[model samples]
Target chain A: MSKLTIVANIKAKADKVDLVKAELLKLIEVTRAETGCISYDLHQDNANPAHFMFYENWQSRELWQIHMNNQHLADYVAATEGAVVEFTLNEMTIID
Target chain B: MSKLTIVANIKAKADKVDLVKAELLKLIEVTRAETGCISYDLHQDNANPAHFMFYENWQSRELWQIHMNNQHLADYVAATEGAVVEFTLNEMTIID
Candidate 1:
């Protein structure tokens, strides 16, 4: 298993950013607590109010998969259903 | 002059990334050569072929403005006219 980088691009609904933000921060904390997590960061694009990006580094793909299936994630997905407009998930293997 | 961090999120046309990429790399090199530039890096989102990000650091906002007005950047913008779908520019003052 190699190190994995996940870049999740999310766009939350207008005026619901606070609710979305709360859920995302909690999820980020939980993700960081996961055994395989190396680092997890949440960034909101300054110019785009609805745009958000999560930068995550995991020890292995297996551990990352475990993270995806975690109980908390289900709640997060359900809570932010319509609030999220675009969600793009990318898996990266860093070269430099 | 305070440090300036610029995050430029760009979306290029499908299958036209090669042309856009060439322009971007050239602009990046020119920006890096500027006296105020500290670092300039270009990254393409692995899962989103159209998505690109330029992480740039400059000594000041004035220098960044100069970079923006440079002839190379004008050419880059013109060359990538229809090829670009979205371009979000963010000015950040680092806290940490």
Candidate 2:
């Protein structure tokens, strides 16, 4: 199985930045402890406070899929439903 | 100085995937050797061949700015001018 890299960008609604960010930060600890997780780091844009990104590396795509379908992720979706305005996810492979 | 994380997404014109990728790859060696570089990893989308991203970490934003203004980056811009269709850069700080 090949390693997978995920770049997920999340943009919060103008009035919901804190709400959205809190929910995102909550995912880090649990996700980092999951099986096959290599690294799960979160960042907030320096110039755009409402923009956040997760730069993650997983042992394999299959394990990443498992992580995606976990209950905590569902909880996140429910918690930030309307607070998130734009979300884009890219599943990538390292060039090397 | 605070550390900086950069998420740069680049999309190539459908027919120019190889060209754009080659040019992007050309920056790795020199950029990695730069003074403040911590990591300069590149990735290509698994589902979209034309989508490429660079996930970089630097010792500080000031050092990153220096890297941005260096000749290799300028050369990359010139080399992939018409071949790239979209580009977005996010300068960020790790949440901790």
Candidate 3:
């Protein structure tokens, strides 16, 4: 299990749903192009559209850390600063 | 945006790590051949090897529910009953 995976659950403010969604979707394309990126996806709760989750796989924890500090991610975070109401992050590794 | 995704976090009892892992990996091959399964991946925690997470994608929620009631899944559940210590599940839709 060498992959560094990330599962991040996030909630957006009611009024900022569209804005938050656009930014999250942008992460998929941008992050996937970054070095060491294996997989990057975004999911939303069907019952609660404002609730979202990020599913990502990186080559290593160190690379993931670099992704966390990347300018694109930082920009997304900055763009959605207060729009996100709540978030929970989980860092994991592949079990296969 | 139509995909039904599953994020299940599970923890195996300290002594049952190997047993739980075998069963979890078995799911990948078995589930992938099922009707609507798109992607099925298994992951563990770097700090806690016993901790596992399932990242799955299905064509539809109905198909995913059918998978939940499938015999293979039922058997896996039965096989690892006591080995799993804690679990949390989240059902979501792809945010495209």
The C-alpha RMSD of each candidate to the native structure, in angstroms, is: 4.3, 1.1, 2.4
The whole-model C-alpha lDDT of candidate 1 against the native structure comes to 0.79
Q: What TM-scores do the predictions have? A: 0.63, 0.96, 0.85
* Chain A, model 2: TM: 0.98
DockQ for each numbered candidate:
0.23, 0.80, 0.62
* Predictions in order: chain A TM-score: 0.95, 0.98, 0.92
Recovered share of real interface contacts in candidate 2: 0.76
Q: Give the C-alpha miss distance for residue B22 in model 2, angstroms.
A: 1.1
Question: Which parts of model 1 are misplaced by more than 4 Å?
Answer: A1-5, A33-39, A57-63, A78-86, A90-96, B1-7, B13-15, B29-39, B47-50, B55-64, B78-96
Q: Sorted on lDDT, highest at the top, how do the candidates line up?
A: 2, 3, 1
- lDDT per residue, candidate 3, A1-96, as tens digits? 266888888899999999999998888887888889998888888678898998888898888898889888889999999999998888887665
Q: Write the per-residue lDDT of candidate 3 for residues B1-96, one digit (tens) a residue.
A: 266889888899999999999998988888899999998889887678888999988998888999999888889999998899898888887665
Alpha-carbon shift of residue B39 in model 2 (angstroms):
0.7
Error of 2 at B44 (Å): 0.3
Native-contact fraction for each model?
0.18, 0.76, 0.69
Q: DockQ for candidate 2, please give it.
A: 0.80
Local error of candidate 2 at residue B7 (angstroms): 1.1
Taking the tens digit of each residue's C-alpha lDDT, what string does model 1 give over B1-94?
A: 7877776788888978888877887776677799899978677776775677776778999998998888988999898889998898877643
**Evaluated with lDDT, which candidate comes out highest?**
2
